[model samples]
Target: MASRRIPKAAGCSPIRAVLAGPAENVITEKLILKPAPETKTEVVQKNTSVHNDNWFELMAINHLSEKLQAATGVKSMKSGYESLVEATAMVSKIYNPKRQQELVIQCLDSAIPKIILNMIKTLLPQTQFTREYFAAFTTVFFTWLIGPSEVRESEFNGRREKNVVHVKKCRFLEQSNCVGMCINLCKMPSQAFIKDTLGMPVNMVPNFEDMSCEMIFGQEPPASNDDPALKQPCYKSCRAIQKHTAKCSS
Candidate 1:
């Protein structure tokens, strides 16, 4: 018998396929806006790009700054972090290498506390719907929830970290027919608006009509069709027939 060739085992985690397509191609509850596969979403909508870029820059600075902070704890003199060599050399005070390593290790281990991570995950649900706005939201939500972290404030006392980066409105150019965009945005399910924008017969959805608001959710509907706001065009359409009219009235 011929010898059989054995195939190599795959890595434990499967790699995701890269998306390669135009920027306009997006799938959302709203319209399908396409986006280029390779482009970061930050680039597609340039107005939103500025705020998003700050996040990426901040994350990058974090890597470099970690060494600077850790270096302070290092009682010893050397650094093996090659990527940071230039940045480190600028402010690195020579210390005993062994003591520094111990401090660095201890500082790293205790850097991210569990309480903050739990708070972050709780407030920021990792979902497609809110991903675009999550980082900015995380900043806003944290300040609202627990106020500032004592350590961060105490360390950088005078200089304030600006969490609220200004995000500008995307006023797309007049080049394309924005009619489609306008109509789509005006549709219901904005998630922000609780009441139906359509004012569609609530009955359109299954069983929504059969049960009155009061019956279903223990909340009363408008008392009378005469109420100006609740009075819909449907009332006028059927108003020809009086509810109290006799059959002989015909």
Candidate 2:
């Protein structure tokens, strides 16, 4: 009787056949891999919320907070927006209105090195480009204090330009909830800071009704007496008003 011949698979090796043993046995002895158990560390990471969106945002907040504390000589127990508000309130208490504005400009001066300021002033010409550049820069670098913002078109020197930063809702104003704080601690100081340190003038017009603010770059800020923001009344819910002993010059 002729011996029956066994056919090899298209790419099967004799070694594989030896390792797998008989085809029937190989089919029955299937190997299943169970995923490794999740570690406690992985579980914790999965449940954790990401507080800082990016490294730049976190660094900016920390540096500004440190500068604010240094300017006011008051350490904040909290961080970020709360810390800024605490330092601002302390600054208001520590200095006169004029001095409060001065300290904030000084804080910004220290926060940004004079050399960097010089470079910005010397390199960026005072033109529409510079205004638009700083407007875009503000939206990117100052989102922590101002919240989400966008650059919009506005008339600068009778020409339409995209040099306005419309802050949807100012975090500083909303959190402080004080018109005086908004003007002394933020609007005036910020305009001065930008003008002196960045060599670009800006006018921050805040709408007390909705807490929104529009920063018009290249426009000089109006005088305190002429400013509508200064004339606005303090909120009844203001923390300063809540203190009863404190008077808010909103």
Q: Which model scores highest in lDDT?
A: 2
Residues 1-250, model 1: lDDT tens digits? 2343445467655444454666678665766789656433223333221222245444543553464455453222332222222222222223332333343344333454657645645664533322324324533533221122111111112533322212122211111112121111211111111122111111101111111011011112333333232222222111112321211110
Q: How many steric overlaps does candidate 2 have? A: 0
Candidate 2, 101-135: lDDT as tens digits: 88888888888888888999999978999999988
The true-structure Cα RMSD of candidate 1 reads: 32.3
Could you tell me which residue pairs clash in candidate 2? Answer: none
Estimate TM-scores for all models: 0.18, 0.75
Error of 1 at 196 (Å): 39
Deviation (Å) of 85 in candidate 1: 9.5
What lDDT would candidate 1 get against the real structure? 0.27
Give all candidates' CA lDDT scores: 0.27, 0.78
